[model samples]
Target: MPSQRGSARRRQRGVLLAGIAILLLALVLAAVLASALTRGKKEESLEPLRWQGRGTTRNLREIVLGRCYGYLAERRAELGDKDCLKIWESLKDAFIHKNPCNATTEDYQPLMKLASHPIPCNKSLFWSKTNDLVHLYTKSSRRFLTLEDTFLGYMFDGISWCGDPSAPGINYESCPKWSECEGNPGSVFWKMASKMFAEAACGVVQVMLNGSIETGAFRSSSIFGSVEILNLNPDKVSEVQIWLMHDIGGPQSESCSGYSIKKLKNILEERNFKITCEDNYRPVQLLQCVHNPDHPDCSLCTNSTEAP
Candidate 1:
């Protein structure tokens, strides 16, 4: 009987040892699984921001101001903080009214201008050297002026809107100095002359906004930005648009990122001017200029909303 009891005890001890081994193996497996899960989570958290989706490229200013004011919360602290707040508040106080349709400033000039101004387009590439242009931003109200200024300077139908070097009144179109190329519509000489005028007007605006042209610029130099139009209500107003034609060399980009629509927006904001509506320049380059050689020359292309 004693020998039998000893054998049974030994069998029980072996079973206990087996159970311990199984438990240890399970614990090790559990630890390995936890580590793997942790590593995966870390990798996911550390992934870099890749702009993989098909969206346009945005300028730094346009991205910051456009996103910040429109979608994000109002009042970013990065800009001239409290002082900016006060300035914006005062500016908006004169504009925002008990009545949405008839708000105006203390000077009454803005009100008069809004009243007298001809049917305003939804968006326009305005040409001005006026102070009224730059006062659109109001951090206190978190409002940004809208409108994308695609190109600056005076853009008239016949002339490129730059003052002629030969004479103040004469432009690229009718320079007596260029009697050699009169009635030539748009000769090579005329095109170059127009470019010069556009560049000069753009340069002047740039100087006023920034201390140096290299540090900052207008038109061609203005890149990747946004402008929030102030007091320009689409519902109350008429037409609005921006020019996006490929008159210059090289292939015109279908997307805004490849172009400087945002940059134009930013430069205008710096000048205290703002615009509303998209700068209508999509990828499909259409010859909409009245001067197009093709049939159905649509010269009446001024701010009629973007075509999807």
Candidate 2:
């Protein structure tokens, strides 16, 4: 009778173990289903960054920067407006002479002599992916490349590229193709060009390691078309964007999806970019490339009735 009881207890224990195994399998399946359901809901909540042809594009861009990245457009945001002015004066003086690339020429020494950043590439900017874009996040059906996050990453990398007190640039290789790339002999030049890279002052610092960061001259004369600076630290932040006029076609060919896609792909893979361009030349759908330290002068953000 005792032997029979022992056998019976063993059978009961085996059944209990099997039951627990089945329950655990069911829970795993349920969890997976829940995850799938959550993902479906998120996809339904967001929209991609669309190229809303023309007038709305610039406005939308400005909105993205202002509402997305926390930066200001005013000249006052810059610490040394006077120094920039000094740099510009030096540039103007150098340009007065017929020979331009002779920055080493005594006539152009003033421009070459930079007390701070952009000595190699003055008035430059940086572009990079943000934390959210890199790691990505899901919320509802909406997909947002958060402006603040991405720009912060760019600025962080950019500052490091420029470095403190901003060193002078030593490398400015020819842009190769003489035809469309750098066509108009001496019309273009790199003020600050260096292959040596450093950690970003803004982002994860790992960003600048790729050598895609740059600090060169922007094509803007007026502050209206100038580059905007977005410094990221702990204390402050605000969203930002811009909306500029875009031709459905004609002028600014960089807007072509083919070109943009290629450029983006290059940036992603190699962290390298070559903006061998002239102002307002090729056909364009819209100007899509804009990010932290590498973008232009503007700033703003307002509450949206449309849900974020």
The candidate that wins on TM-score is 1
Report the lDDT tens digits of candidate 2 across residue range 1-308. Answer: 99999999999999999999999999999999999999887665332221111111222223433432332233224323324445434544443322222333444345434322211111112323222322222112122222223222222221111001111221121212223332111213221211111111222211100111121122222111121221222121121111111222223333223333333334333432222322221111112222332333211122444478
Candidate 1: C-alpha RMSD to true structure equals: 24.2
Q: What's the lDDT for all of these models?
A: 0.31, 0.29
Cα shift from native, residue 97, model 1 (Å): 36
Please state every model's RMSD to the true fold in angstroms.
24.2, 27.5
For candidate 1, the 10 contiguous residues with the lowest summed lDDT are 148-157
Top lDDT prediction, candidate number: 1
Q: Model 2 off-target regions past 4 Å?
A: 1-74, 81-85, 98-267, 271-308
Write one digit per residue (lDDT tens) for candidate 1, span 184-253: 2222222332333232221111111211122222345221121122223334323323333333232334
Question: How does model 1 fare in lDDT?
Answer: 0.31
